[model samples]
Target: MRMNAKDEAEMEYFGSTIRLQNENVTLRDTVQALNAALSARDDELANIEDELSDRENEVTRCERALELRVAQFNQEAEELVQQKEDHRRLKLECKKLQNQNKIE
Candidate 1:
């Protein structure tokens, strides 16, 4: 028995359609797998970003602490210099008074 020409054409078209459908299914699966991997990578990226933000805040705090310490040191040094100058002036006054008394 031979297939009619119209029936054979119909069968060929059906085969092509089935093959296209299979190819579409494979492409869909590949896309789904890629999406899953991308989602996992996105989670990792978020974690890394959070860690970097935390480090940046910590650095800022340390910088502030260092600035405060530097300011304190400067103030202390100024106070020490003033005290030394005052001591020198008092000694000079005392020596002048002794010299005047000795001349009399």
Candidate 2:
């Protein structure tokens, strides 16, 4: 089958057009896939940020609780020290009275 020059030119042009269309379709699909991947990554980043914020809040709450506990412990320690001093004073007074009676 011999193709005339005009027919040959037309066939070449048709083949070139088909190749260009295929390339365009491939490029479109690639761009769509990349966009989808980028969107998923952005969502993941947002979720991580939310989780980080929550954890930071929890840490702050724990620090406040610990501070309260420390304050309570200090107050209780001060009370115990005052009680011990009172006990010591009473014991000394009782001994002094007993010695005075013996001297009389």
Please list the residue runs of candidate 1 whose C-alpha ends up more than 4 Å from where it truly belongs after superposition.
none
List TM-scores for all candidates, in order. Answer: 0.82, 0.78
Judging by TM-score against the true structure, name the best candidate. Answer: 1
Going through the candidates in order, what is the number of backbone clashes in each?
Answer: 0, 0
Q: Scored by Cα lDDT, where does model 2 land?
A: 0.97
Q: Write the per-residue lDDT of candidate 1 for residues 1-104, one digit (tens) a residue.
A: 99999999999999999999999999999999999999999999999999999999999999999999999999999999999999999999999999999999
Q: State candidate 2's TM-score.
A: 0.78
Name every residue pair that clashes in candidate 2: none
